[model samples]
Target: MTNAEANSGKKAVIFNVQRYSTEDGPGVRTTVFFKGCPLSCLWCSNPESQQAKPQMMYFSKTCVQCYACVKACPNGANKIKDDGSVWVDRSVCTNCGVCVKVCLADARSMSGKKMTVDEVFDIIQKDSLYYINSGGGVTLGGGECTTEPEFVGELLDRCYDRAIHTCIDTCGYTPWSVLEKILPKVELVLFDIKHMDTEKHKELTGVGNELILENAVKIKQMGTRMIIRLPLIPGYNDDENNIKVMGWFMESWGMDRIDILPYHRLGENKYDALGMNYSLGDLPNLAKDSISRAVKILGSYGLEVHVM
Candidate 1:
């Protein structure tokens, strides 16, 4: 079933509604982060978003030893250890939010929430003055905004009706039809290019670049403004050869601009909270020199490059 069909109730699963964002798009904007993603990027910052369902997150430091969660859990997922600290068995936990509901110390929480299109717009509308003043509106990001194409489409349509500028921050790993449905309402598309080499792209992001590349061309042909974003991961896609290949793609495809995002450990603690192992443990952030080198290459291709 399509994302919208699965959510026929007209509600989409989202994790966050961040406001006053300057990086996502043109002006002061609100970014709605959806849950679920098809790719398993090794350096995923938002590890909690990879799952399409609501997930429980634990903060051990906040536990007050009230044992409320242990008493509230129906699945016996919460256990009191000999040290008086509770351990959560994620496998047994159904993510029913029972523990979160009973947690007095706010230690346990759920990541995703279901909200209707109008409900999301209500929050966006509060920032309407900011959007109009800054030329920024709302940006639908992921887990892959296209995963909920119908919901996002409806949200974008409403924004357009209100004259709010729209943007979608995507990985371009979705079906073209899904994108086609939303593009009419989207003013800008923040498309990601993980790797130009097909096999390398698959190895890093768990998918080939053929479909993504094809969609990039299709998006351009659809008359949508697009920006190519590259997540600069050290010792991965930041190599000279890979950067050269990426530059060539921009030049050949006539992409107007590119955004190079330096990889960082900003999301490392998130994996711990989600009870997942971080693939790139303690990896250093991409150096300024490397970013400059990449900028030079893309500049040689006559493409506008911005480090985000």
Candidate 2:
């Protein structure tokens, strides 16, 4: 039986399958972003990915005030307030996606969809020529792919069988047993490290970094190719103390490559559409000088620094 045939019963709630992406991994890649997460980071760009189930997102600016959604919603979830703003009643909303269908401006959408391994695999295989010529393949990312270990493992196993390079973009906040099963098939791991300090880590991201830090050590020992991705947030992890500690940790773990992702406000609008509050209100992007300083500090530990 094929990999998909063996895992036919398994399905994962995925938010997006971004195609022709070069930044996610080596060469060109198709990033499969799954829904569900353990960590609620203060600066998460993809707020829609945090939830396990499907969510209705409304882009207020693009809405044409067609009122089609108001008439279509059986639960009266979509309403227009007296101020001419769209209001979504989460308490009454079943997330049945009725309102999303009637959105004339293409402003409303459901964030997640359930897909079987075969369904997603068909899409991945369609880009085989791109993966072959460009030395890239598939990237399984989150909310946290490990949250749905069985489905992700089976999918990655399929990639391994086909000799297509596979990578995982993860936060590393998962049980070792999960990675133990999936890492063997993954050619590269884009491990995200938010903060080195455990207390500060918890304060910023909802969970402590003990497990994440430990997993980094284990992943290195497993002889799997991995890169440390640090999303450098201004006035947060860019402090000298944090940078120094991260460098020390990198050296201790024998991890040399580090990708510096300067913070941006790209996802701010998503929070509004999702009717969720963004914790970091109006935080500006990381300055060029701060990025340079971080690069210098990490480079002090002899890391192969790549600014993304």
Candidate 3:
């Protein structure tokens, strides 16, 4: 298809465009967080990213009980309670963004926006100098980058056409056909391996690990540069046995590098904002020893290990 045709009628709902992120890829890079995900991971940090469409976010701390949203909402979704605190009836809220646009305290906010390929590229091109100098480029990530294959494919194609390095941060829950479409344009793959066991993986992520596991091998076969990432949720996938099995799987697949991402309560507040329960409630950050031990286990298999 022609570039113009590819750009036409193609748009994705993106929740964030994080610039100068050091951890997403190499050097200074922009991480485009696509909205919507198939898997509902127990410890999702960006809870707002779960939906495919735009959503509302309320910061109660900044609300002054002025009932501005109450008056602005067409659905009467916003309400002022007895204690003079503002309460948002998310059930009735349509996320019209009317309340968000009028709120001056930066409390009421919308999470995602629709953007065409060219529109998104306009923002990406702003950092062309940094990307060129620092060997950094664009990275498409969660809720799952592969969720919108065409949009992501076109975006990555554009980046590659500009001689910019590209990456995809994926949960590996999507079909291999989707990954096949994305891998050719992606220079690096930051693939998340949530769990090794099927039932346990299903329990934590609402999906079995079969497809994810299958795709990991396919990714390796495709000869894509991939770094396996483990979320390291304590009392879940962080057990020594799971780590050993993961290490064995990587070794069996000749996957040499792994990054251990320790779990944190960072998403707890986001759950509150979205009015959702945090599955890993009150779970402390993965202890340093756990991190070190995980590294040692993977390293023992002659694999390069990192605590990212």
Separate clash counts for every candidate: 0, 0, 0
lDDT of each residue in 50-160, candidate 1, tens digit only: 998989998888899999889889999999999998888888888899899899899988999999987888899999999989899999998988998778877877787
Residue runs of model 2 more than 4 Å from their true location after superposition: 1-5
Error of 2 at 161 (Å): 1.6
The global Cα lDDT (0 to 1) of model 2 is 0.91
Best by lDDT: 2
User: Per-residue CA lDDT of candidate 3, range 1-308, in tens?
Assistant: 54633675698999889888889988899899999999998888888888899988888888877777788899998877788888778888888899998888888778899988888877888898999899899999979978999898888878877888899999999987778878988899999999999999999989999999999999999999999999898888888999999999999999999988889777677777666778778687788888888999889988999888
C-alpha lDDT of all candidate models, in order:
0.89, 0.91, 0.87
* Segments in model 1 whose C-alpha atoms lie over 4 Å from true places: 1-9
The residue pairs in collision within model 2 are none
Better of 1 and 3 by lDDT: 1
Query: Which 10-residue window of candidate 3 scores lowest in summed lDDT?
Result: 1-10
Candidate 3 lDDT? 0.87
lDDT digits (tens) for residues 206-244 of candidate 2? 999999999999999999999999999999899988998
| Model 2: lowest-lDDT 10 consecutive positions | 1-10
TM-score of each: 0.94, 0.97, 0.96
Q: Quick one: ranking by lDDT, best first?
A: 2, 1, 3
